[model samples]
Target: MSLRTRFTEELKAAMRAGDSARVSTLRMITAKLKDTDIAARKAPTDPGVSEEQIVAMLRAMAKSRAESVALYRQGNREELAAKEEAEIAVIESFLPQQLDEAAMAAAIDAAVAETGAASIKDMGKVMAALKAKHAAVLDMAKAGPMVKARLGG
Candidate 1:
């Protein structure tokens, strides 16, 4: 199923299950998607945001909430931190499973090989290849250091 359809169905299910946090989070996602769709409509031929874009959006949302979690913790607001964490969990439920260390390393190796990345200068090529193939699963922030090290940076 398309990510949008899944979100809609899941939202209904969350509502049926009386999951207030999940319902709220999913509603936020839908709102974000609607805004994205409207922005995409500037080009008449645009088909709206793709699945990859949706996943990217979700990832951004999760990252923002994670930062909120950190800030809340630093401010000694455990309750707010926990709430942000809960929202992150709900957002992540729609994302693909993240690659573990070994898998991520393998993916990076494959991307490097595929791109024939010879040095740190080729890091952009390698990273682009990885993003094209593993945008949803790989954490680019963590992958950057590994990619640099592998390229002898």
Candidate 2:
């Protein structure tokens, strides 16, 4: 099922089951999706966001939570950090299955080879290739340096 369909059903289940925390988290996701859909309408695409865009939104939400978790931990707020971690788990539910380390390395290798990326200047080509095929699977921030290293950039 699409992420939206599953999320709608899950929201209903959470409500019926009195899962307050889960319900709140799901509501946050739906709200974020609504905002994304509205933003996409202003662009050259469809009236609403696509599944791909939704995945990107989810990744952004997850990244934000990760940063919050780090901040909470640094502030010695374990309880708050745990909450952020839980929210991250909720946000991650909508993402495509992530690429394992081996899979990511292999895919990066292929993209480097395919683009004949010999130097750092070709980083854009490698990034574009990876984004096209693996946007929802790979963590681009972490992958950037790896790709650069492979290209001797």
Candidate 3:
């Protein structure tokens, strides 16, 4: 199912099941998607955001909430942290299962090999290859440093 369709179906199910937290999180995601689509419409010839872009947005949302969870915990706000964690769970439901360390290392190795990347200067090519193949499953923020180190940066 398309992410948009899944979101609608999940939202309805949440509403039916009286899952208030899930309902709220799903609504927030749709709202964000709407806003993103509107922003993308600025270019007359541009289509709105693609599914990949939507996944990227969801990842960003989850990452932001994770940061909030950390900050909330540091501030001794357990309730707030828990709320953020719940939101992260909801957001991640639509994302592919993340690669574990070993899988990620293998993916990076494959990208490096595919790109014939030998030096730090080829970091961009390797990263681009990884992104093209694993944008949803890989966390580029973590991958950046790993790729850099692998390329002798």
What lDDT does the true structure give each of the candidates? 0.94, 0.88, 0.94
Let me know the TM-score candidate 1 reaches against the reference structure.
0.93
Provide the TM-score for each candidate, comma-separated: 0.93, 0.91, 0.91
Write one digit per residue (lDDT tens) for candidate 2, span 4-113. 88889999999999998889999999988887887768766665877888888888898999999999999999999998898899888778788887898899999999
Model 3 — which ten-residue stretch has the worst lDDT? 39-48
- TM-score winner between candidates 1 and 2: 1
Residue 58 lDDT, candidate 3, scale 0-100:
95
Q: lDDT by residue for model 3 over 124-152, one digit each (tens)?
A: 99999999999888989999999999999
> Tens digit of lDDT per residue, candidate 1, span 25-123?
999999999898887787777889889888888999999999999999999999999999999999998999999999999999999999999999999
Give the clashing residue pairs of candidate 1, or none. Answer: none
Best by lDDT: 3
Clashing pairs in 2: none
What are the per-model C-alpha RMSD values against the true structure?
Answer: 1.4, 2.1, 1.8
